[model samples]
Target: MKPTSSLVWLRRDLRVFDHVALHQALQDSAVVHCVFVYDTTILDALPRRDRRVDFIHASIAEVAAELAELGGHLIVRHGDPATEIPALAAELGVGAVYCNHDYEPQALERDATVARTLRDAGRRFLSFKDQVIFEKSEVLSQTGGVFSVFTPYKNAWLKKLDADPSVLAPYHIEPHAARLAPPPSPAPALPTLAELGFEPSNLAELNIPTGMSGAARLFEDFLPRIAQYKDARDFPALKGPSYLSLHFRFGTLSVRHLVRTVRDVMARGAGGEGAPVWLAELIWREFYAMILFHNPHVVGGAFKPAYDAIQWETGPEADELFAAWCEGRTGYPLVDAAMAQLNQTGYMHNRLRMVTACFLIKDLGIDWRRGEAYFALHLNDFDLASNNGGWQWASSSGCDAQPYFRIFNPITQSQKFDASGKFIRRYLPQLKDLSDKEIHAPWLVPRMLPLDYPGPIVMHDEARKLTLERYEMVKKPGPSADQ
Candidate 1:
């Protein structure tokens, strides 16, 4: 039997169009009320002025306004979701609460608590898959077993999609939006930044677009250049990436729509060689999410258990090296510039992410977790699953990760990707006058030249030799004892 009334809880999936939870709620209930809670349990850990908070603040306002235009009301609350969601549903006299699924371990725990609370009150808590097209055991090997490697998994993922195109079909919203209920006589006003105990960040100053409209604008701008993505993405000075990660992180954009659009463009023979390559990148995102779902231990320890046996730098000297790397004073031009970019802005190029991660783990002999934590705190597009997977990949501790012996040489990486020194010079103005050749290695410049930048903190050759010895435990091929 359909419920008389229902409430839809918004989490990462913030938008209204093609929203599964919202669609299901409206279809099943005579009247529906939408809500979003500013979860303090997660927010209290963040700094006072964070770009992600600012982004959400702006984006949710747009969602509320859109709902109002559609003759629906959106209730905003600020508190722990475990308490706030059930409380709001109770106050509204909703018989059922509908929401999309969350995969992170912490999120799973919170959802469980909410579900139990709703059940105790004789109300049902319903959840559906909306974040990813395939999750859990949906995509597996021919033997119905989980695949550890990416290539084989990706092939199976593609084959499954080809067999069932309906998975990409979006959930309808307009047909059922009329079931939305109006606000009560006294509606709760949206909370201010001060009321929420957070300050405004520099997101506005950076000119970063927010909300569903912002995502649309970014996607439109990138379509013309999608063909060049494969060749141009590695160069930091070039505008190659779509720059829609922030929207993707917050669910302002739909993965289904993105895939459908890219495929349509290819069907018309418009996209170049970059089309297939970009599709593979999208698959990589799902692959990481799948890895996290099965291996919760990757959050604290290594994905490959044997990697935990390796010793990392400790004590004061290691601390000093880490500080230098964080402050962009490592003296390696590419590494310094990458760090400077991340510090100044919340975004970093994909190539730079790998370069910096490799340098921190291999060159400085620091643990990858420290670097992963730093990125998690700073990045606007930070997702725990992807961040942890990336760190493990750099440290040679994850499934299908780079070999321990394959340490990246920062100097050659800089020369190959940013040969003109344009990217490095943009972030490190002190090295602007240095020649293209000299910019990559400022220490190599003539002694007569006055340079303010510090010399290389650790020589690449010496660091490489030390790294090989440090990772000696995992050199021989063997199964993970702990796993």
Candidate 2:
């Protein structure tokens, strides 16, 4: 009898343990070969000193080392995945290729091409759900259609998990000893960042380590704070957010394991408000993923077409406003501080994300897509789905988005969230001496001020009036049809 040879192609899900596709390949086949392709399609479009690329490179190195210790080596390739996967499969004479499902628009298209190439070569192509607990149409409304809203989808998701909780079981990898074949002659060298026309980035300086080990460390550190997550997550002054989002984005952390842990705590009534709230955040993650899957158009366009009717600031004025927003000179301390946090650390708190996003689209009358793209360039944990969803949500253009007239008052926000101005002072050191009451709106303070600090970039009242006028141009005095 011949051994069933299969190739395990790794993408975002980079870990060896508790990986559904990897574990399945090891169990169902005799020899399981692992491979990671540095997709040229994505890399070529990125800037030379992209931190995401550096993060991926470091993560793959960790993965390769782990697999090498188990008597197998990861075959690294650089090119169009559609070409590389089939070429490697032929070289290894593998009967099938297995991988986890990816929901991004580009990934789906790339996978389709790879699937076609593999099928032409008479090889089996298999993909499994390993990332999200519920995907595609898994958790639907009673009428049997995809859910556009989150609450009902979440209720359905919880109900499904309660009925069949075994789906969250850990998939321990058991690689066969004799399965790893001898290396092919003249193995290709793993391409260096320089070779790929990418320069060195300050990924280490950001203190965001890559790989499963790093993910484990972060998750462990976050567990003690899980109980207080609901209260602490909103305040930027505190170290509250799990900070594991980057790990989750890159597939270093397993979604199934997270869901299980969170659910288990909730079941025991131990997590309190934190459990349900954090779980809601996770559901938001899943919801955004599902939204991306269902409406791939949201990647570049508005989720609701009516939003496209809303004209944005253009010409020189738009550029000026965008520049102000990006440079942390938007006059709003919380907004400025949030932008600075994103620019300096590549991470922004959830509350700040909402506040700044609203400030950009509503206060500045800028397009939500502009802010979305800026975030895409800077965020370390930037997922296209979540970023798009968040930007659209802030702009009142996405499904179940905030009401158009319910604009966020930046001054009020800073006062409520960062009462002592500690968060603002951390990022805007020049404003360190401001009183707690005056910190939210520093222009109102007296002459006792920092010499270096600039005055308010744009008057909040005028900006708010301009925003409402801009919105009125698109909408009349009537209820929105989508609502």
Residue by residue across 204-321, what tens digits does model 2's lDDT show? 8878878888998888888778889989999999988888888888898898898888888888888878878888888898899999999988987889887798888898978988
- Please report the candidate that would top TM-score against the real structure: 1
List of clashing residue pairs for candidate 1: none
Clashes of each: 0, 0
lDDT tens digits, residue span 95-153, model 1: 99999988899999999999999999989999998878888789999998987899999
Top lDDT: which candidate number?
Answer: 1
> Candidate 1: global Cα-lDDT?
0.89
Which pairs, if any, clash in model 2? Answer: none
Looking at model 1, residue 214 earns an lDDT score of 94
Off by over 4 Å in 2: 1-3, 175-178, 181-190, 448-451, 476-483
